[model samples]
Target: MKQIILYAIFVIFFTWNPAFGFLSGPIAGRTGAPDDICGTKSCNDPPVCHGSYNINSGPASFFITAPSSYVLGETIDVTVSFSNTGSGLHGFQLTALDASNKRVGIFQSKDNTVQTEAYLNEYAAHTTVGTARTSWTVQWTAPLANVTYPVIFYAAGNQADGEGTPEDDYIYNTAAVIIQPTSTPTPAVTDGECDAETIQLSQNLLELQKGESREIVITVKEENDCVAGGVSIKATIKKGKKRISLFPESGTTDEIGQIAFTITAKKKTGKATVVFNADGIKSKLKVTITSK
Candidate 1:
């Protein structure tokens, strides 16, 4: 009995990893070719291995590079690159979270504030991937107003076979988006109150697509919430899946509650949830379109 207990303890000790436990999985997706150990062999001839059982995956690595420091009210640009180099398909997802792992901010729901990265299998040539193994870039710019906090990047994908590998989820790497000391100070506004009353109702979400036209409209509202001036006021928009900036500038609201601006192909393709911010207030709306 003592020998049985000791053997079980040794086996458990050898299998634990500190960072993530069950996140890894069995091989996933259909197999193009079996491992050398099981090449063209029947079950009786050789045994097969399984892992991350959703899709084939490889080593996934990414890095975030931004301006050395951030400044309040100044737009700071962030760039990230992802690389897949394993035998199977390896991929990941992205979002911004504070050091404590809480997602904070109004990205993409309003102004199309930032854009996300897609795998080559999802899009055409935006970021090429194949046997050579390369990195793809996704760019986003946000107005740096919050005090320095850690931002996290999440990357997730499928695992092909059931060999207990990282083909299904984030397998190889992950990190926090870095922010340097702010050149300007942040105002106290963490109470969860976003001063939303200041937002104009007509101006809502912005739509984004990879290679199509997007129309965004903004306006300055009077005390009664009517358009005081057609001059374009500012706002931000985001899509729910992942925040991607559609346009850099505000859209022009015409006499009516219609503000129209077009998003170009340089911006990739995906569904986006938009939010409009104005006069210290914020509001939300949705726009989703497919590219030509």
Candidate 2:
């Protein structure tokens, strides 16, 4: 009877308790929490012992690395690294938001170690908890259009002592910010004549059969009618659903102020409009896809 009671106690303490640990990933909205209610409250609740969980304080054990500036509609890589060299398993969650607090970018995991949450599709977390991972890399695609500057990337990570419970574990939160590159004004020319900078496309309209592909060249010209090289360009689908697709959606012009993109017709047959932005100048291409 005594042995049975001891075994029962062990089961209740280790298995029956609800505050063991996430073991997978934390709940949604747990990154960069402004309060304890939605952040570490559940993890630090009863049934589990508490430990030091720091929020954007002390020697940062968790760090976020990303470009200081990003081009509109471009996909950038963001990495979250754990600097603590201690012996333990680690897990993390990362996300980005605009100044309005609205989720700004789409996050995609580069490997199986991380997974994008289905709740808002904005949160990326570890696939399995309690792993000896030092860092995670995720792709974040900027919004199709420019929003308020300074998109903030927030992340939260934990170092677990490989214990089955939350005790002796440490949680850390940190953030980083990125902004859009500012456009420089073109200098005025006092010459005989001046033409405003323009974005010219090889073809303004396209007709392609289903599963057909076509390439288009974009050229940028300055006010002096000279080819302006090294110009940033971004393309976005303005109309139609997913009937058409474009490759190299965003890039910089070559030495000849030219960039090429391939457009392909998908299964659906319909009309689609692709808007292109060269620096601040804008242009559009109309595409019609028909049955083969």
Candidate 3:
């Protein structure tokens, strides 16, 4: 009887009303591994976390339009959109990186380049596609144009990809643009850009009594290991220098967008702030641990 009850609870908890990108990847396979990552085993069907491909044969499409060239100090706008053509819901984030995959510019939020409208869609029964419509627009003073830049659309890599889940999934694309000054030099943007994408932080936070420790799966794209962009990621806790709590063994931009990390809350802790920053954006979340 106890085992039966426990199994029932597990079923209910493990199977939430999941209906989004997390469910849109490749076919079924118990492996849970994703394809196209740096180097890791691949799942049978790849448990969704589908990479630049789709499993449910979902209809997914995306595009971006921007000026081929701009003058220095001129505000540049980029528009991007995608449609999920299957029952599986979809979400995406965008990021502009230099040729080196190093994140570019300053956005308001430090989280993934999450979509503002909760990047979700619904797939009808017996249907292979759902649709999501959105455009990414941002203005920036032109940079050196001749230096080709890469615009990347970030879909959460396989949870094995790097860090964070679909809720925290950040999808972005990279492209190159040129800057031409109109006979006048523009001042450098030293204070950082004022653009920010608000991401719903991971929903798990716990309280640990003295000596009680909990390991958390921290998903952060900037902390990802396998992808090519080599995004310089740094972390801090309690406003001072702190050792990184969690990390992935290897790889980047897998089918699932996740970088697994562990965090342990020790004694003398009541409430603490775990702050993460990357690509000029910052996300600060609260973690509380009560004393016994």
Model 3: weakest 10-residue lDDT segment is 1-10
Alpha carbon lDDT of each predicted model? 0.32, 0.62, 0.30
lDDT by residue (tens digit), candidate 1, 89-122 = 3223334433333443322211122122222121
lDDT of 3 by residue, 25-51 (tens): 221211111111211232213233333
Task: Sort by lDDT, best first.
Answer: 2, 1, 3
Task: Specify the highest-TM-score model's number.
Answer: 2
Model 1 poorest 10 in a row by lDDT: 1-10
TM-score of candidate 1 on Cα atoms, chains taken together: 0.30
Q: Whole-model lDDT for model 1 versus the true structure?
A: 0.32
Model 2 over residues 1-292: C-alpha lDDT tens digits? 0000000000001211246535566666666432212432344343443333323222336778999767777788999888845745677777776534557889987888777855366888776632557788888888866454336676777666665665555666566657443332333433333322788665566655577666666767675555566677999989874889888889987654667777877999889998989767899888877663
* The best candidate in terms of lDDT: 2
